[model samples]
Target chain A: MTSDSRLSWRDVRDRIHEHILTGRYGPGDRLPRDADIAEELGCARSTVQRAMQDLSDSGLVERRRKGGTRVRAEPVTRATLDIPITRREVEQSGARYGYQLIRRRMAPAPRGVVAAFGLGASRPMLRVEALHLSDGRPYIFEDRWICPETSPEVNDLDFTEESANEWLVLNKPYTRLDLRFYAVSANPRLSDLLETEPGAALLVIERTTWVDDAPITTVKAITTPGYQLLTGS
Target chain B: MTSDSRLSWRDVRDRIHEHILTGRYGPGDRLPRDADIAEELGCARSTVQRAMQDLSDSGLVERRRKGGTRVRAEPVTRATLDIPITRREVEQSGARYGYQLIRRRMAPAPRGVVAAFGLGASRPMLRVEALHLSDGRPYIFEDRWICPETSPEVNDLDFTEESANEWLVLNKPYTRLDLRFYAVSANPRLSDLLETEPGAALLVIERTTWVDDAPITTVKAITTPGYQLLTGS
Candidate 1:
């Protein structure tokens, strides 16, 4: 690509980003208007807008109408549909991450799980309960349920090599996914797995991924005591 | 707005929403695909897609490619930017939410705030600190910085009726906001406001809001002993 083509929206955006990050352009500074920026860059305003979009996506900048551009002051944590791979995270942390499949079954999911997934009383589902570990320490207890109607092939898949999310991403392409977070008092079942007293405060993450509006899987994770979740939209 | 032009997409969307909320289309149910739904409704596939988007946005439906649509097994909590609203939240709990404007000053924002707003060091800024009471009990201590050079009218406004956010929204429209949540050990200042012992756990929320690319406000809120954040996203 020639210089003109290389003068992409990203190029304009990065330049602006560099200025903000380097303090060349301070926070609360009014950005040059679209026409002015386009003129200064000798490019289209659309290109500048695209760059701003990229910045916004990364949580690096805040955009406002009529007010203009501003540098974000908070530490931006980029987490997107994080693949809940404690193994990968622990390994990256130079700590050992391990998992043991405590139990596995192909029975109907519990009533709450069924209701959450809108599964009927008759639909047979796969449920897996396991204790995930970090260097031989209990890390998370996972209770997972999946609708065979969405992926009848789950019964044939193995859990030892990769996570369900990894398998689904590769074998089953999902169009969308929803992740939820909340704090709850841990129950007897989870307290033991997490090494916390029953009724201990805990952070809960529930995820339901789908392919074209069809249910793929539902996984609820209970983390160890004192785990903090830092995520972004 | 006409009945016919009301668009089959919206009609199907409303009907589907009512079904889900009413428990007719329970979770985990496979939704008819574009062609099937379009045929049943005597509408275009595009219409079905648009309707599906609404369901997806509302955290009620999951969409996957080739898999089809499914009711969410668990409703995901939508995460807000978690704007610092101590009074509203504290009072909502039936706790007395109070504010003591401990200090107020007009000067150039600190380097961080100035840089955040892309403003010169000499630009006028406002600094305000206050305490929030929950049910007649102190719940939060807030410290805020604003770039009034970007919002000249803010200097003349009163914050007694609404909150800082409400005031800013009414006076200065923002386009983007960044929020961060973290756990910190309380220091003396925070401990004093929250009425907690030093080193107690305090949930901190830091935020920066902007318009276009211009930074407007920066805030840090320190919470009392009982702080809860609930979100499904």
Candidate 2:
């Protein structure tokens, strides 16, 4: 409750959250300053600041340089999503994972690939397609492109045994990443690849990574029907 | 770089990121201790610790309590998703927002709803079905259940003028939240409600929130066809 008691920042955060939940501070209500809250709670100002930061991060409060802090009128449900490598994802689902490289070739980046990478021009890149299986059933079909200029090591490794999904994730450390999730009705080609009926709904995860402004790789992980991604806050 | 230069933790983080990006510290490789890094970077040990925390948060590294920090063998793309209230989401996308309360009734919690809330037994709950519109077209159809015991104030609000989504977010601050994203093929009912073709692919955002041990609300916001949820890491 006080600095003398040494309440952790988490405890302080919970206390502030309690005030908001109890309607002592309603939506769009400006909260007491860190110094004021610290004085009232007998805690250090820094402790209050730490608690406020956590509250803001969780979308409970909005902090402004001039306006101090106010509870958000419509707080968002903020959640952190960590998307792991495909092998790990499959294994975590308690299924035997199998992977096979469908094809690998050096080809010019397509218009969509070029736009995804924001490349000025279409360029030759390593295009790899692979299938990931769970319990011997197709789980995900991945179409990927790797920029040779940034990840030149891909040119030397054959993807026959290791998927580009796992290989690039392990070998490359991207400084920037772009991720997207959407739903698509499977076309004939996709449906055949995924062993599903045509027009089956599929979830697609598109990701692109860059290291210091150089593109590392871009991939579309098209999941099988009924795949779901879960997270918590 | 070393502590005498008084470099900030952000500078230290960027320097460490560069080392990993340049292959100085390869995947699964351990780096110098915080003390050693501090000595090398001429910063305080606490500064290095702070940098390590940020690196771990961003999925660039994994820090153990005693094993020091190592580059993740397969770095997951970590992204924070802030799912705002539906009306705000529509408006934020530069579209005209509208809400219509389709149905509201006191209904016994269904098996799925009870399981979602982790309730011991099915109980009576206020079920609210609503449609959110963007540019006069259906954007999301939400089926939600509110626990009256936890949110007694909801009984007073007529949802025809104000949505339950906005009301709950403004009034309730939950201690816990569960979120899930998946694709669902529209059934006949959903197709008619959303004005989409039958079997159209739709993105479903399911969320459950709890205040301490009490369930607050659970909702399945099924987005219209072609709706994509995007984020970055």
Candidate 3:
């Protein structure tokens, strides 16, 4: 209803992107104002604004409060990754989802866990070791540490019927999140747990979350060999 | 000036996000209309719209064309990843950047390359093998294939002085991109090139890009051992 023309925001965005691809607007070049662009393209200003927002979110442009929009001097390959709960992932993959709780106890946070949370010192936290399976095959081995001070409910519930991954993701909303991906060689323990050969290359995803200034949890999810993580388009 | 008060879009976003965190609106619950929320909060409807856009982008909610906005039933941990040019990445890390072109020739697209582009048949493409160095040490080994039909200018450029990674990123823009990450064990050839021990676990970042439906390029950036890719935030 905003525009009489049939041009959608996606069409406007593609047009602007074509301008950049064809060098009409080079790097660091300022683009026309939204009103000007809208007039030129015979569309509504809101349409142009939506297109500009998309370009900005994709790292193709920089928009300032009053300085207007400009092409980024250096473009990056920006990607969005969506990591779902393990059970959902397996189910969506057409596999029977299974989980096993290996170990659970309270222990002092390790040096790595402490560092991951950016804590001043180590503290007693709940440590959980679990394995996710797909079709009775080992899928991922998770080593997690939860802060009881932040979520006291964790101390009462045993993580047997439900996984900490699913529980925390649903109950605990994080204000800040840190994610990193790396590769690790499977050692004896990891090989045994994952049912893979020793020295097999494995992909590792480490995640740390915080609510305001309080650390919630930090986890390292190590996958079996040949597992690949893909971007969500 | 949208709001008479000092509330910004981020303030509105956090306030609404807090509602979700406190269980005021559970998963799959529809939110109040933007105008209603704006009236309640004494802010402009556009402010609420911006907040809802952010929440939707972060996968916390879903907005429909006419159904309004609702909390996502299945929540996902969404992260944004920004991969800069190899040269810029090294320079930003305060290291001297180096590049080496191992080989450059025209070859038939391999099975993996064809599959990456979702092409039905194999065709001749420009194959470029290169190495990126940090402080004169092996950093990333890249195996790339460029579809000359999509990017004919690639046939004229020699990748000795400037890397293909930098050149393509600066010149050619893609409409679509596919990114995947996995682990690979260094074989004898990979070990010799990367100067790592055999069986060392290395992270491989595979990227395929397309302009509309035409495939632009596909590259596998094999990173050195201990290399880590982190989220932008």
Interface RMSD of each: 9.2, 2.2, 1.9
lDDT of candidate 3 over B71-119, digit per residue (tens): 9988888888888999989998999999999999999999999999999
True contacts kept of 2: 0.74
Maximum-DockQ candidate: 2
Candidate 3 lDDT over residue span A54-104, tens digit each? 777566888997899999888888888888999999898999999999999
Candidate 2 segments exceeding 4 Å error: A1-35, A44-50, A62-74, B1-35, B43-54, B63-74
What's the chain B TM-score of candidate 1? Answer: 0.64
Model 1: per-residue Cα lDDT over B53-81, one tens digit each: 76665445788856889987654423333
lDDT of 3 at A180: 95
Indicate whether candidate 1 or candidate 2 has the larger lDDT. 2
Q: What is candidate 2's lDDT per residue for B62-95, written digit by digit as tens?
A: 8886798999887876777888888899999999
Which stretches of candidate 3 lie above 4 Å from their native place?
A1-30, A40-47, A50-54, A64-67, B1-29, B40-54, B64-67
Model 1 chain A lDDT-worst window of ten:
A75-84
Query: Which wins on DockQ, candidate 1 or candidate 3?
Result: 3
Instruction: Report the lDDT of model 1 for residue B69.
Output: 91
Best of the two (1, 2) by TM-score? 2
Residues A128-217 of candidate 2 have per-residue lDDT tens digits of: 999999999999999999999998788898898888887776567566778788889999999999999999989898998887689999
